[model samples]
Target: MEITDRTFPAALVALSGIEFPWDYNEKTEEPAPSNIDYEPYDEFDSAEETTDWIRSWTGNKELDGDAFRMFGQDGTGGIATLWLVRPGQPLVEQPVAFFGSEGEIGIVARSLGEFLWLLAGGVGPQEAVEFGSDSGVPHDELLAVARKYSGIEPRTPAEVLAAAREEFPSFNRTVESWCR
Candidate 1:
């Protein structure tokens, strides 16, 4: 799916004004270490770059990046992406996933809609998969944005994380298989 999809762009626009602790400083290529927050990319990674990174990450030149669309990253350079596991489906239908810089991986949300709720609940990709740390601090602005775009009822962080993992139980194993 194209990165210019309606829902994703709308969500990004909604989140444009909010400041997070993990926002990357392009000048320095670093993030503040104080708070658990998301650092959205100014744009999605190009197809070529995504493919190259995936090949490098898995050490499998035979693999292509068509299965993923990386959109953002965490403070530590952990990436957040739309995992297009559902064939012939729109981008919104795909699951949102995270691949941490520290070798952590997980499906964070069932879809972009669920992802908004995850963000509303103050859980970023890294937080959801890594230590499963619950910030317990809700972002009302993000919640509002999520509701505006998704119109889905708010869910707890734990619920979103669990559902995603349950839905894609083999994500880790599948990804690991690609590693040489």
Candidate 2:
């Protein structure tokens, strides 16, 4: 489905257009530390693309990617998506999650509200793999973006990530279990 205003939150739709900063080695053209490690897509990935990706990643053709609304990716092609687990709720209510190209699975934030703060704190969904080990730097633009859209009060990246992990402790295990 298209990410129209009716289908996606205003904040998220706006966020899709942001071009995150990246630092790369000149010689190798590879990612370096202190980079945001995220790139927001201009729009959500097509359903066919999502399906093909999931099938390739899981090695299970039966598993569809319908539950995922992919909007961004990392330098290594790790996906950032809204996991539509809450059946009746809107996209903003769903969890923001990461599926790494290296098989890393993590829940970045419980909702879009927290996700904005997470981005403001400079922790992209892909960077979420490090969890408590990394201290996220603040991004001024993202902070403004978060403040513009999120009515919820601000919280540290640690707080948001911890809450998401606590709420879905079995997430990693569940996703890993699906691997063939």
Candidate 3:
């Protein structure tokens, strides 16, 4: 049911510290990506480490592939997903590069949504929501970004692409700046 199951079995296990099949898309509202590599992973150095690592990945769209969705598999089905996409990506080297970039001034939600949308391409529902919420972009802008990327408008793609083009450099710059 979780989107990570479709592509990132390792990240799931590493973060959850639990074992379960990564294949359950057919039964859930979210669908999995057809192209995925489900590989085995070793346990983290510590459960607490896993928890902290996963918590840091939250809200960071740059690491969606490595993000963790935390929720009770049995309690709230909808709340059971998070994104670690930016974690292992090359972009990860520049974690704080998202501030003060052009096109960064849009609705906060839209900005965050645009950020996540750009980072992960086509992510799951729960992950998308979490990304937008975590970005701290703004509620209204997030909604707009969601609506735009939610496939509600034909122009949303163009809008998102524009935002990405504008922000990518800044994101990279932020990384470069931070690294120095």
Candidate 4:
């Protein structure tokens, strides 16, 4: 299935059952801090908006935003995006990566399918790099969803990161080149 297909959204909804430091919204601006819990937005950013953000992030006006489709953000406002490196391939086959608010970047999963397992294993993009796979409590609901959708065996967060980086060794350099 395509990344923009209904299945992708459904998977996100299913994974939403787990408590995170954020809420999913269709649209949001940079959030302000409050005494209450910090709630970040996990909703998918529109393609045009994502493109604009990418261009701004890299300070490169000539770059096309088609290479990325940002889907979520952590409480600290780090972005989670699907990287479309495999030209001519479906979005589902693309890799999922994170660009943190503080210049942290890493490929979190080799594909959308692997990403489901990552969620099931209780690791987000930031957590996977910052805290590793053992940080969060695993969720059964996410596990079931991962099994149902991906049919791949569960893996540790470290394994996921390694696999993605191996498959796309040039990802970091590519992003670096886009930087001003």
Candidate 5:
């Protein structure tokens, strides 16, 4: 299926329902690492909810988040969404972005396909933006999904991240400008 389809594709719908292994660490005797905090939702968040979240996040009532389609959140309430920056393009063609509850904002992938590879590379939205934080990732469960859905060849997390950042170099500043 095309990644940029108008509707949320079946791949994404299935991804949302995946019960990722977020269990406690047997080696560390601790809860799952905070970096792997992504929890995909059963469905995309409503536009109203997205607007409300953006308003709350930026403390700007005038701004609406209709441009974003939030589908997951990190343990700290950071939002992972498709950023509709490429006007007139299909939704999946737009960049994937992360808006952390703690004021982190960055582009995670250039498109939905890259996003699948990012996941396959063992990087969650939060980890993708936190610079150097690692979560002992690469959840093998998601590789099949990535391979099946990714239109491009598999790439490393670093490659996915660098390409995304380069494509949307001004994303952080853009979001920061929106903040109150």
Candidate 6:
């Protein structure tokens, strides 16, 4: 997560272009229905809540200045740039990767389990709080989870994992093994 100033803008621009319809459910290895949606998010609350949840998970990092910087193609478009700054260090624009095609810049999920819960239909802040109780979010960490990624639009499992890998490369094999 070491982002150079030169790469920051490029990362933001690339993130804003993230689209979907990832060949996840539809196994092109086999033949299946086109079950993925690669469209811009239409739900504002869901998107915002999700963003809040991610921010909280990051120990309440600021998005505009000291921590992360968000840029969108337009005021109403999806995200473009998400700059994460380490204390006393240069900013790192996280890998906001995608599945199939790129759509727009999007927020990252706090954890794998949280992403799974969200995929399972946890949409609102209160619902996320309840889901946290049942989904191993831990009582102490509940507030953090609720605060981050709660209303922001979620990336797909594949996308989330990809970004997580970029952020925590060593955890990939462990996380995969655990998921299986």
Clashes of 4: 0
- Candidate 4 residue lDDT tens string, 17-86: 5455433334643222111111223455666788788887788888866677777777667788788777
Count clashing residue pairs per candidate.
0, 0, 23, 0, 1, 31
Better of 4 and 6 by TM-score: 4
Of candidate 6, the 10-residue stretch with the lowest lDDT total is: 96-105
Report the C-alpha displacement of residue 149, candidate 5, in angstroms: 0.9
User: Which residue segments of model 2 deviate by more than 4 Å?
Assistant: 1-6, 24-34, 131-133
Clash count for candidate 6 is 31
TM-score (C-alpha, index-matched) for candidate 3:
0.24
After superposition, candidate 1 runs with Cα above 4 Å error: 1-8, 22-34
Which ranges in model 5 have alpha carbons more than 4 Å from their true place?
A: 1-6, 23-35, 131-135
- Alpha-carbon TM-score of each model against the true structure: 0.84, 0.87, 0.24, 0.77, 0.86, 0.24
Residue by residue across 85-145, what tens digits does model 1's lDDT show?
7866678767998988878899999988888888887778877886463644577777887
- Evaluate model 4: give its TM-score: 0.77
Per-residue lDDT over 91-118 for candidate 5, one digit per residue giving the tens place of the 0 to 100 score: 7778899999889888989998898888
Against the true structure, what is every candidate's RMSD? 4.9, 3.4, 15.6, 6.9, 3.9, 16.2
Q: How close is candidate 2 to the true structure, as a TM-score?
A: 0.87
Q: Please tell me which predicted candidate would have the highest TM-score against the true structure.
A: 2
The superposed Cα distance between candidate 1 and the true structure at residue 175, in angstroms, equals: 0.5
Better of 5 and 6 by TM-score: 5
What would the per-residue lDDT of candidate 2 be over residues 46-129, giving only the tens digit for each residue?
778988888888888887778888878898899988887887777888899899988888999999899899888877887777
Better of 1 and 2 by lDDT: 2
Q: What is the lDDT of residue 117 in candidate 6?
A: 29
Poorest 10 consecutive residues of model 1 by lDDT? Answer: 1-10
What is the C-alpha lDDT profile of model 3 across 28-101, one tens digit per residue?
A: 54324321111213421233443543334343323322333232221123322222335434221111112111
The CA lDDT of each predicted structure is 0.76, 0.81, 0.30, 0.68, 0.79, 0.31
Estimate the overall C-alpha local distance difference test score of candidate 2. 0.81
